[model samples]
Target chain A: MISPREILETINMISNENLDIRTVTLGISLRDCVHPDIEIASRQVYEKITRIACDLVKTGEEIERDFGIPIINKRIAVTPISIIGESSRGDMAQIALAMDRAAAELGVNFIGGYGALVHKGYTEGDRRLILSIPEVLARTKHVCASVNIATTKAGINMDAVAQMGFIIKQTAELTAESSSIGCAKLVVFANAPEDNPFMAGAFHGIGEPECVINVGVSGPGVVHSALKKLSPEADFSQVAELIKKTAFKITRMGQLVANEASRRLGIPFGVVDLSLAPTPVIGDSVAHILEQMGLEKCGTHGTTAALALLNDAVKKGGIMASSHVGGLSGAFIPVSEDAGMIDAVRCGALSLDKLEAMTCVCSVGLDMIPVPGDTSEHTISAIIADEAAIGVTNNKTTAVRIIPVQGKKAGDPVEFGGLLGGGVVMPVSNYSSSIFAQRGGRIPAPIHSLRN
Target chain B: MRAVITVIGTDKIGIIAGVSTILAEAGVNILDITQTTMQELFTMIMLVDISKAVVSFEHLSGRLSAKGDEMGLKIKIQHEDIFKSMHEI
Candidate 1:
């Protein structure tokens, strides 16, 4: 029989690899809280979100303390305001403001679903919600927006895609004085999954129950440690097996946490997103995992293949362990948050071009990347457009979270510290795409546009 | 007669393309193929019609096993109806 301490050590080894419960997102549907009267709807929205999400942070914290592991983010995702606002006679902006106030009052870091899901066709309310995003996000502190433009079964929604391309540009323009970073809080997706607990794409869909609890798990450090233990002479196949076993163990922990948390919270447990979500920690870098795999640096010739293997292994392990696995469950390469990634940029081992290529195989795109302060808004919009195109074309979820640090040059370090990580501002090629970004109409959906 | 070929074991180079080429050369028409790799483990399902082929199921399995030895892939050929019944649940 295995000794309990040894089993515990194995558990610790698995948990320590970038593995921790990623997010314990409480989904609260605000549709029932709506009223024909604007003030009543706003008040109801506030009361419902606050009531349902009341124990979210405390419960997550208690679980972390009991389990002796970290729960990185405690968040809330509400039903898409576009859907709720449709039944209300009040202004959609008022609903957004109320939602923002509720999130702040509840002390949650971010509240998702301040946008629309117009994959095939847009409703009047969705159009309003789309147009109101720039104002809603700019005026509010922590409201994140997302728009689903396509899905595999439904094909691609070109009209929504085109509108979103323009909306991103407009949102950037509206927030340009503040580094045009509001667009960073938005995501465009193809098959936008229902139970994704991560943001800024998380939203409570109409198909979901009244309330539920979902957890996202991360463990890049654990995977890296496993890879590090392998002999330097080990070939790629060995490396792949190690990653799969590590991911299997890590995902098992996630399933446990999700089940325990859901049981404690008295709500149905949602999926465990087996994403390698990184923090601002020194040892917990996905880039470091690649380096440990014998790459002189990340963002090189073998990067895509490496990412593909990691992504596939993670999904396979997680899917086998739980029927509830969902969310963006793959390796993440957020630039600013991972130390090895920061160093890679500082040493020129990584670049925007390589980052884009890697995103095709990873979970998210261009996340937390810091560009030069002086980079043009049009250029930022262009980058968002490019990333969105990849997600739409390939039928995956991708997002951009770029920060243009004020007065920061390309090589200078900006320390957001804590979970945001520190990073050297990366240089975007000086080439300007202002004219194209400024054209601002949606790129019509691909000919395969099917989802309505 | 229709047949279902199940490939299992480690994923290496040229599993599907190699097996498909042999089936094609034998005048087998593939109807559907699904494959997934988990770490070193690989699983594949191929639905094909071998009624026009010049060989029996045992003969085809024998040939595939020989090729499987060469490529380190395990290939099992079964009747399509039997496979469907076994897998329906």
Candidate 2:
């Protein structure tokens, strides 16, 4: 029989490697709270969310204290307000206000689903929600917004995508005086998974149970450690096996923790996202994973292949261990969160070009990347457009969380601390994509699209 | 009777061609086949109809087993309906 300590050690081995439950998202469906009286509806929405999510922070804290594993963010995702309030003419901003207030009172860091799912066409509610994002994010401190404009089965919603380009530009312009911070909280997605525990793109699907606890487990450091053990003479096949085994062990631990947490909390267990989430720590970097795979550094030759292997292995191991595995359960190469990645940018070993190439196989795109302070709004829109294109073409979800550090140039660091790590602003190629971005038309869905 | 054959083992060359060849030789018509290669592990699922086959289910299983041995594959054959009922839940 296994001792308690042994079991604990096995489940918590990577805790010291900066491993944590990245987010514990409580998904609340608000479709039933709709009422003709907007005020009554808003009140009902607020009460429902508050009542259901009241235990979220407390439970997360308890789990953190008892298990000694940090639950970094306690978040809530409601049904897409647009669909929930389809009949309401001008209640989106009011509802968003109620959500913001509830999040503050409940002490959750972020609340998602302030946007729409307009992959095929836009409804009046969706358009209003899209228009209200600038105000919503500007006025609310904890709200995050996302729009799904494409899916493998439904093709791309070019009209919605085109409108988003304008909306994002407006959002950035309206909030530019405040550091254009609102754009950082918004994501545009394609093929978005329903059970992702991370933000700013988590929402309760209509099909989910009344409530569930989804855990996103991450440990770039653990994979890095395993790679450090490999001899220089090892071939690509050996390296692939090592990553597979390491991912298998890590995902097993996630399974155990998810089960234990669900049993303790009395909530139905959700998927365990086996993403190789990175941090600002030195050893806990996806770039280090590439370096370990015999690349001189990340952004070198064979980087994409190495990342593809690691990503595939992680999915395979996680799927075998849990039937409920979901989310972006692959390697994350967020720039500012990983020290090695930041260093690579500083040393010119990584560039936006290479980062874009890497995002094709990564779970997230252009994440936590810093651009020059003077980067134009059109340029920013262009960056998002490019990432969105990749996601649509590949039938994967991608997002950009870029921070335009004010008054910072290449090699200047902005420190957000904690999970949002410090990183230097990298130079954006001076060459302009503004003309293409300014055209402001939707790139039509691919011909093979079939998603509903 | 319809049957499903799941082939799982270390992947080598000609696993699909070998298995399909055996089924074809037995006068079995395959309805569907899906194979995925994950590193060294090769997994395949084949749905076939055996009611019109020239041989019995046991004989087909035996012949497939013999072919698997020749090809170093691990093969498991079951009635398609049985497999679906067991898994569809």
Candidate 3:
């Protein structure tokens, strides 16, 4: 029999500390849904997703009831729509609507993979997908879009980066009535993970199985509570040990849930994404974990080092907990979705420059930041260029999901509501990067990539 | 299916009587139980086998929860695997 102390601890973590399985993402490959006729292809995409993911939400609920754990989201990730719609000749936005309808019918929070991969360069299909993003995102509420414009081996596609700047601005403009909410659903990535269970960057990669189950686990508050018990004099290694052990317990729960979900759904289990994803609610912010590490606030001088320790220890602890761990397995620092980060931004303790530096050691970069409304498209492009450069240089995945709130300036409070949260807009550099962005071409692969 | 049932609140009489009645009516057999007081609050942990429960797991859970609410206690029932997996490996 399990000891009472252990059982009580698990229950306390769930009821008080916000430990829960973040998402049970169903990855459905849409490679076979391609056709020259756009209508037929769209129908096939909708049918396949509905048929496969029909039980996703219901099953997740059942699991939640039995285990007494909250499964916050049941989402779907399909093959990148650019590849799925490559041979189709009509407006690709129709497919976006089809996916949105499927999500509505099946009752999933979001359906990702309205995306393209133009890391080296764009094909005609990729170009059309990129161009249609603003309208498609404006129209579809559940569909998400991501474009991979850079990779370590392929360097950066300066043209795609430049184009995305305009697309993001246009998305914001189209959804301006809703606080530029459309831009919140789109992410631009360098070295995007195919098996990511998180959004707005999740997509079922071409190499994945026809159908698989991936889980993303979250528990920043649990880590924060654990660290609060540590003595102030606890050294860095002790801190790391505590974090790693806490992460192990958390990921072990993730592994159990992933395996159970896979077994119940009769789908192959892919991986457990060991990420400390944050929510807008109090007590669940990753920044609080950093502050618990003795920093007065997040994004201080020692913030990067604190984040690096957390990210690496999480990965290290989680790796041994599960047999297969993949996806962006580290701490996420999305500004709008975290209360501590929102406070940090409002208090001026955190800056875009400092956030960018923090991303070098974290899982993803430049996530969920709302810039000034009048921020230029060229500057957005240059921002993507900088993030891409970091990913390429560091050989790690980095992404940008910045929203240029229409008619809003720095320090203005912006509310996106629900899980998206609200935060004050942060200012960006006024210096123009238009000329640099206009110089379009591919940035060649790094010299270190030749080792293969 | 086996599950862990926990009842916690102010240490007082009739808490055990109320919880045990609900479990007995649901045809659940308590396999093991331990009780203690922490921070001036009563905590009881019960390991129960519910495979032969007369009602659905959800229905039993709701009944137990409502009973807890009536008694001014925080009660929860979770599958045994959750505790084992987190603590064992």
Candidate 4:
């Protein structure tokens, strides 16, 4: 029998500490759904997603009821639409609507992979998908779009970066009535994970199985609670130790839930994404964990070192608990979705520059940040370029999901509501980068990428 | 299959009797139980075997939870695997 203490601890963590499975994402490959005729291809995409992910939400709920774990989201990640729509010569938005319909019919919240990958350069399909993102995202509620413009081997596609800047501004303009919410559904990535269960960046990779189940587990509150028990004199190593032990327990729960979900759905279990994803709820912020590590605030001087330690220890502890660990398996520092981060930003303790520095050690870069309405397209591109450079140079995944909320400036708030929680717009540098962005070409792959 | 049921609230008479009654009616045999008091709050942990349970796990859980609500207690029934997997490995 499991010890009574352990049982009580698990219950307390769930009820009080917000320990829950963040997502049970079913990865469905849509490669076979390609057709030259746009309407037929769209139908095929819709049929396949609905057929494969029909039981996802129901099964997730059933597991939640039995295990008493709150599975927050049941989502679907399809093959990057660029590849699937390559041969089709029709409106890409039609296919995006198909995905939206499938998500609605299956009762899933988010259906990702309305994406284009132009790491080196764009093909006709990639160009079409990328160009259609602004309209596609504004029209579809559940569909998400990601564009991967850089990789270690391929370097950065400055052309795509330049294009995405315009697309993001257009997306914000199109969805301006709803707090410029379209930008929240779009992510630009360098080395985006194919098996990521979290969105708006998850996509079923080409190399993945035809159908599989991936789980992302998060518990910032659990980690925070664990650290509270540590003595003030606890060294950095002790802080690391406590974080590892807490993360191990969290990931073990993730592994169990992943295996159970896979078994129930009759899909191959892919991986457990060991990430400390936070919510807007109090006590569940990654920033609070940093503050608990002795920083007066999250974005202060020691913030990067604290985040680095937290990220490394989480990965180290989680790796051993699961059979497979993949995706963006570290702490996520999304500004809007975290209460502590929002406070940090609101109080001026956190800034875009410091956030960028912190992302070097964390999972993703510049996530869920809302900038001024008048922030230029060229500036957004320049920001994306910087993040891409970091990813390419360091050989780690980095992404930008910045929302340029129309009519909202710094000190004003944009209320996205739900899991896409509201946040105040943070000020961006007023410098112009139009000339730098207009220099269009690929930044050549690094020397380290030539190791083959 | 086994599950862990935890009952937490202010100390009250019939807390054990009420919880056990639901399990008995559902044909869930209680394997072990431990109760403790911390300050003014009471906590009871029960290990139960539901292999021969007449009701579904969800059904049994809902019934116990509804009973808890009536008695002003917080009751949670979770599969035992969650605790074992987290604590053991």
Best-performing candidate as measured by DockQ: 3
Candidate 3 local lDDT, B1-89, one digit each (tens)? 89999998986788888888999999999999899886687899999999999989999899989988888899889899999999995
List candidate 4 stretches off by more than 4 Å.
none
Error of model 2, residue A234, in angstroms = 2.1
lDDT per residue as tens, model 1, A1-452: 22223333443453345457778898888888767787888889889998888877887776654344567788989888888887767578888788889889888888898868876678988987888887877788778898876554554555565566566656656666665557667777666777789887899988889988888878888888878889999988888888877777667667766876788889898778888887767668888888887788887778778888888877876676665877788988888778888888888989999999998988878888877667776676667667877877776877666766656778887776556667788888798876776664446566665646
Locate the minimum summed-lDDT window of 10 residues in model 2 chain A: A1-10
How does chain A of candidate 1 score by TM-score against the true chain A? 0.88
Model 2 clashes, total count: 6
The per-prediction CA RMSD against the true structure, in angstroms, equals 17.4, 16.3, 0.9, 1.0
lDDT of 2 by residue, A313-419 (tens): 77875676565888777898878778888888878888888889988997978887767677766677677777877888887888777766566677786665566
Docking class of 2: incorrect
Q: What is the TM-score (0 to 1) of chain A in model 3?
A: 0.99
lDDT score of residue A271 within candidate 1: 79
- DockQ of prediction 3: 0.89
lDDT score at residue A264, model 4, on the 0-100 scale: 86
Assess each prediction's global lDDT (C-alpha) against the native: 0.75, 0.74, 0.94, 0.93
For the record, the alpha-carbon RMSD of candidate 2 to the native fold, in angstroms, is: 16.3
Residues A1-452, candidate 4: write the lDDT tens digits: 77666777888899899999999999999999999998999999999998888788999999898888999999999999999888998788899999999999999989999998899999999999999999998899999999999999999999999999999999999999999999999999999988999999999998999999999999999999999999999899999998999999999999999999899889999999999999999989999999999999999999999999999999999999999999999999999999999999989999999999999999999999999989999999999999999999999999999999999999897789998898789999887899999899999999999986
